[model samples]
Target chain A: MSQIKPKSIRQVRAQWDGLFWTTMSVFGVFYLALIIAMLVADFRFTNWSDMTSLLSDARVRFSIWLSLISCTIAAILSLWVAIPTGFLLARLGSESMTQRLGQRSPGCRRLFNWARYFIDTLLDIPIVLPPLVVGISLLVLFQTPVGRWFDQRTGDLFASLGYAGIRGITYEIPAVILAQFTVAAAFAIRTMRNTFEQIDDRPERVAITLGASHYQAFSLVALPQAWRGIVAAFTLAWARSLGEFGPILIFAGTARMKTEVLSTTVYLNFQFGNLRGAVSASLILVTLAIIVLVLTRLITLGGSSNKGVIV
Target chain B: MISVQQLLLRQGDFELSQISFEIPSNAYAILMGATGSGKTTLLESICGLRAIAGGKILMDGDEITRTPPAQRQIGYVPQDSSLFPTMKVHRQIAFGMEVRGFSQTERNQRVEELASSLEITAILDRYPRRLSGGERQRVALARALSFRPRLLCLDEPLSALDGDTRNNLTKLLKKIQQSESVTVLHITHNLEEGIQLGTDHFRLEKGQVRAVVGKDQGGKNTA
Candidate 1:
């Protein structure tokens, strides 16, 4: 008997497959094209010769520098928190902590479940709640005694260091980083948690069996494999911090040449009816975002050769 | 010698209870079980990777029920070769010794010796991804045996190899076991291979254990 599919059957399958892919390609490619068109149109209306001077403007430069510095610092801190937190969440005994606690007592199990539920819900609050809500929450937090005490201690240290640029910890560079971290770290945590969850725990276990301690196993087996995911997480957090506006504006007041970041510069320019300046700043922001996005893609693609531990 | 008494473990819905066994020092014991019979679970428990509910694991006269896997000094090769992809073969073999605070010269000497014996000396610089399945298994074996573990746990070590490769490796493994005299807890579905190597035979069914065959001091079947 002939093994090949019948010509009529093949034709029918090909026809349906072609139609499905064509429909998918039409909408998918067009939406992406529209965004590209709009961005290109923004450039088309601009004067190329004046672009350099627009970017080199003192206020613009200061805003960009501030945004860069703050976002970088925030992202570093976010990763520091995210890596460990994400791993902990991912490794929290897939047997269910609540179920394991059942061995203790029924009441303790209930408490464990509630605690787990509360923590999980809290993780997504930054992403689920409105950005402005995060800003308002931070403002409300700093008014409390605990926050005031922390602020005073940090403020005292900075004041003693003779830094005239910083006023108080609440309305300065530190506040900017904190505001950015609150939101960016949430995204990074989700990313890294998913990464760790996807990875099999067998290699780490094997490492431990081979005379490596808990920390050694994690460092040797888990961390090395998690490098790509960590890079991706950092890229996302940094990009998100760059675009964060509400929390920074609400928590850290935009003081010109002090706390004024790029996002606030765009807002202030638009408010002052400096349409040209606003558009210019937005374009710069878009360009920077694109660079970061492209860099992440390249890094992911380049590191695709190593598939991590087999299990 | 390693001994397990009244071991109980629950993983999700599966319950392995009242498991008991003893493998004498420098003896090869084969644990035979069907699919989902909790053989791997028992091996992991022995290595201190699994949480046992009520049990005692005595190693060389020391009660190590709560010992960490690192302190247990039990080398484990899981069913699938889970070689760390980022490391070279040498690094994988040396990882144990490095973590155990062995000096550079000792680590290098042991790694090279194991690599040569395992026929992976040429591929020591190669990453796990570049190796063949059989080669990966050999590297895993080298890594497991590098630190001179008190007991070696092989979780279906030959399951992934071809007939010829499996036969050759079985002979090689037999030779290594004889020379090292490290207590072995070998899990396998291959009955013939088990009978060939095992000084003691144990069967696990529905999470329960039975002494199918026991061997005497002279390695003769006394079941």
Candidate 2:
């Protein structure tokens, strides 16, 4: 004898079959309304010339290029500096310092702890300090004698390579990159150090035992294992630098077709009542940001998957 | 032969003093202890990863107490089975050879030999994360052995494996030891494993060597 299927009241609802569809539809409607409103507003006052000129304008092109190049430079420098800092913080704990401190007095440990706290507070200053303040501080420091001396010593050739006859860190690409790096690297170091800390020390120890030296162990073992986290840190720093505004404005003044990065160009366009130019530049900025985000996601995902392939 | 003498170190709240031991040429020496009994510290001191506050380690009559870990020529397989996650199994096995300046041909040959012996030939293209616990241990062991060190030290080699896997790995380790004729200093808390593989066993307690026994029932109080 064949068995007959039993019917239950509201079987679809009871089984959660329709719940997903309903949930999706609710979110879909909200998203659709937002998109429709944006489209209507965009179409009502949209000027084709503004969009076209924004892309075709030499100044706008230069601004986009400048932003990309500076942000890339800042991000690379930050990673190069941050990785070592993070490694030292994670692997070399305060135990050695604590031992030395113990020789002096118990209070020294407390002092060292306070020092760590102070550094942490210093790191937090970037997040809270307005970008304009950061830029002004940089400008003030760059104008100092010591700063000029150091710059002349290190950047004589770089100055010669530039179109303008300028010496030391002021209103230049390097200055902008340096300011962004100063803020970005500290945050990157904090992020990467936390990640490196979470990884077990056993791997590096194992590598050393397997005949790899300190550098070999770090490069081949620790760095590779922590690749995903490092990539994430680099992405964060890069994105932060790309979006940087006030610091770039004050340190690297807005010179059209030269130092006019995306943010500054947009600001200048708005100030001059060139609404179309402003909107076009804003769109370009948004498009660049979206492309970067998508690229980062893809790269990170690929890197993580590559790590997973190792076993 | 590997010999340690008068080892001493201080790390806040714990002190290691006068710890000494010897493993004769090509013999398997098992170091037995509870956690925090300074077993790992002693191993690390020999490998030169940890600085000895006072003491000396001699391998084949050459002093290596002040040597860096990379130059020590001691193959170390840690408890966590540290396989390079970015590498394929083959590359992981060959990394030590590359570091030690071995020729590419020799590295490849050594990897092939180790992989086949460990029955991991099929997993050569796989990564460390994709391997099972036992497979990981096998690859880690293979990598360590590829270096052809004077001595191989394992810190709780089988501690991470399931019972069956541990038993199987013990057999594999014994086979590798016999074939390679390599000296070994293994640390473990497992009594059965100790009895099965150890030619001579030393018990450690509270930073001191308690006793040395030739052979006996597993886990008898040495002190």
Candidate 3:
């Protein structure tokens, strides 16, 4: 390792510091300018009459509502599966558990390592695989014998609840929700896993010695401290779901008033040579996505003040 | 009374072999060792927090070597106090009781009693982040003492405090031991603490642990 002399207090601002900031900021602005320039182009492309006409359509209203409702639902459902999965992943190799299990045979430890690898691979699928592939995968699953059996029972249950008109996920509206969940849940898990990792395990161990079972300690001591993280994960997942076009389009198909969310609405309009309607719909989604991203940043800022579960 | 016989623990590159000690009922036993000599590891083993490859740990004439921490009836206070930052002092102290199924009235009364004894009655409503180091230690102590465990395992309980705070807490530890008549296994690197408080002295040297006397018990050369 090369040892560099420490700079004097008077020379705190070095030549390298100025060059570093200038180079990084230029690169940052280059990426940021792309989004700003594209939005500006959208504004220039569509006229006031075209924008007004697009918004007046019943299909546009339904698409916006569908996107908002489905994304929010997917976000909430993702947390239910994500929290425990994230917690387990975050706490897997903590000192207490590892040391306690140190006496186990070599085969057991190796198996434990493999189990962790398997879980991580499973979690990475929706994120690493293309959105269209996720859609195709779900579509392919429904054609299998076991998948068909489960869908038949589920379809009957939905029919009993008067959602027969909605169609029982023969690649229908519910497929939009399934597709969003597949992708959004991976984001939720990543967010929550990082959140849980930030909390110290000492307090949880202390709670255990104080007569709390593992579940009680986690729920009472650990979970309460992760409140901000839960909100962040949900919102980020919802925001990610809002931009899901390829998956929902392939899995659910872009039928207006049925499976037409904002992203798909833009695609459908563009396919039909309705460029004004496409641009208008795209701008609305872009605006909504920017708002969701800003909200995520604000929530993160609010959470930064909390000191976690340890003093 | 608590007893450890031929305890063997291995963690990564470090190993403790054939370590043994006994602390009679209500006795204050101090275990002294250098930084990496396995004093804390042994304490954790007694508390069932660490896996022991070969050993027998008996508390009050019953073998509890493999028992889980929650069922071991051992109160532990780590080096930094490890108080839950999200909780108020009152709730932190009452948590053990809550877990042990104590009623609200019982929990409140016990918290009041421990807080008064530990001289932290004024800061009961404050969070751990708001409390000073001494105050946090007091809350950790109150919490550990909440369920009235038969054995108390303290890992350098006063190591983090300043000189004045250390003296005050040392006095409080003595006072609590006298009042509660609880068996204690305290690990410390301080000689003054061992001499001032211990009725029995054990020291770990080159991964082997045995009892020692007076002036040389906590010395660096003992390792």
Candidate 4:
């Protein structure tokens, strides 16, 4: 056996401090260039004054309001659905249920793995598919018999809820929100499931022995332990919803003071040759997104450092 | 309090065959065995955590081989303490009661008494992560006993402790078992612990019991 010499203190320190800063600086330059391009191509500091004016526009107000409401609904829906999906994936990840199932029937393991891969591929499908394709697909639903039936039933419910008739594409805010959820939820579930996977399963087992049923163990024990990861998933999903362009544009067309979200408003204003109006909306959207991202990053970092259960 | 008759478990390469054992009510039985022995498996079978391919288990004269671990009225302290780190000492001790639907007042009272008795009262608010190894074991014991289980199964409970802590805990455990008269099936590979606390001893060797014909021949048998 050979005795390998250890690195000197200086050598170890150089690897830690020197390589770390160099790697960070390289990525920092890339981020800075991206930000600079956004500023130069869209809005410079000179257009700052126009931001408040754009904020006062009725269409702009509606765009902001629509963005807020739709994203809020999408975020809430994504969290609600993703938590259970993530938890189940994490819990079942280790179980030989598939193995046992596979034994009972040959090709069962292959079928189970194929199904898991198929679902995983579907999740990534939303990520890669163009927003326009999403929008067009959603619009095609309106042309179907099922779509017509849904429209009539929903219109009746809206009427009973004290709203006027929801005729055609003119009243499809909920559809647009759902479209966002379909895409956003995939990313949310993927991230959350990864986080849940990192947690040990022993805690959940202990909870069960302590008298909790399976659901009780999950809700009280596993969920709280994985809360930080779930929060990170939520923030990332919310950001995705905020920046959505394709589905919202196609499914919920750009109508002034109607379906005008921040992204759609920017696009519409740009087409009208209202460069300043476009720039102002773009500027606000960018600013709002930056603020949101920073705030969420802070919250996520805070959550990462948090120990034990919230309760 | 607990009895097993012809319990058999087989999993591919490993097999436990026709294992039978009985512990008198209120007796402390230490399952002494070498590594690869079926000591842990036997305990798991009794608690209904593992299914026996063939056998019958009875708790208080009721056949409970098919019963789930949670419904078995048998509390198990796993080898690693297995405390829920997210829960405070107080909540951890009271969790068994909460699961059984005990009222808040009764649960809290039991928790208080157990904490004081176990000398874990000051650490009630602390998480399991902060506790020492011995403290964790004590909390695990308290949590198990708090439910007033029909039996207590300690699966190498002191194996994770340091030398001094293991010795101290062995004494503490013996005191608790005698006073509470909790039917105990304590598993250990340590000969010293087996002798110190065992009212009855069952030695397992490769899925089979090396039955005690007499004390003179006890230490010589091998599977």
Task: Return the top candidate by TM-score.
Answer: 3
Off by over 4 Å in 4: A1-46, A95-115, A165-171, A302-311, B6-17, B32-45, B50-54, B209-223
Q: Which residue segments of model 1 deviate by more than 4 Å?
A: A1-7, A93-114, A303-311, B214-223
- Comparison by DockQ, 2 against 4, better one: 2
**Poorest 10 consecutive residues of model 2 chain B by lDDT?**
B214-223
Most accurate candidate by lDDT: 3
lDDT of 4 by residue, A1-311 (tens): 96655667668888889889999999999999998987888765336567778877887998898888888789889989888888777666654243224223346556776887777677678778887897788778877998878777777787787775445342377766777787888888887787777766666666666667888878777787776777667776777788888888877777777677888888998899888888888777777777776766665564434432211
Tens-digit lDDT track of model 2 for B1-223: 8888887766556777887778898888888888887787777767776766778889999999888787888888878887777899999899889988999999999999999889999999998879999999899899889988889989898998998999899999999998988999999988789889988788887678654665774345444
Instruction: For candidate 4, list the clashing residue pairs, or say none.
Output: none
- RMSD (Cα, Å) for all candidates, in order, is 3.9, 6.1, 3.7, 4.4
Taking the tens digit of each residue's C-alpha lDDT, what string does model 3 give over B85-193? 7889999999999999999999999999999999999999999889988898888999999999998899999898999999999999999998988988999989999
What lDDT is obtained when candidate 1 is compared to the true structure? 0.84
Give per-residue CA lDDT, model 1, range B1-223, as digits (tens).
8889889877656788898888899988898889889898788888888767887999999988899889998888887879998899999999989999999999999998888778889999999989988888888888999899999999999998999989888887887888767999999988878877888788888677777744422223233
Consecutive 10-residue window with the lowest summed lDDT within model 1 chain A: A302-311
Q: Return the lDDT, model 4, position A295.
A: 68
DockQ winner: 3
Give, for candidate 3 chain A, the lowest lDDT window spanning 10 residues. A302-311
- The interface root-mean-square deviation of each model, in the order shown, is 2.5, 3.3, 1.2, 3.3
How displaced is residue A14 in candidate 3, in Å? 2.9
- Candidate 1 lDDT over A212-277, as tens digits, reads 877887778888888778988898899999999999999998888878888998899889987667
TM-scores for all candidates? 0.92, 0.82, 0.93, 0.85
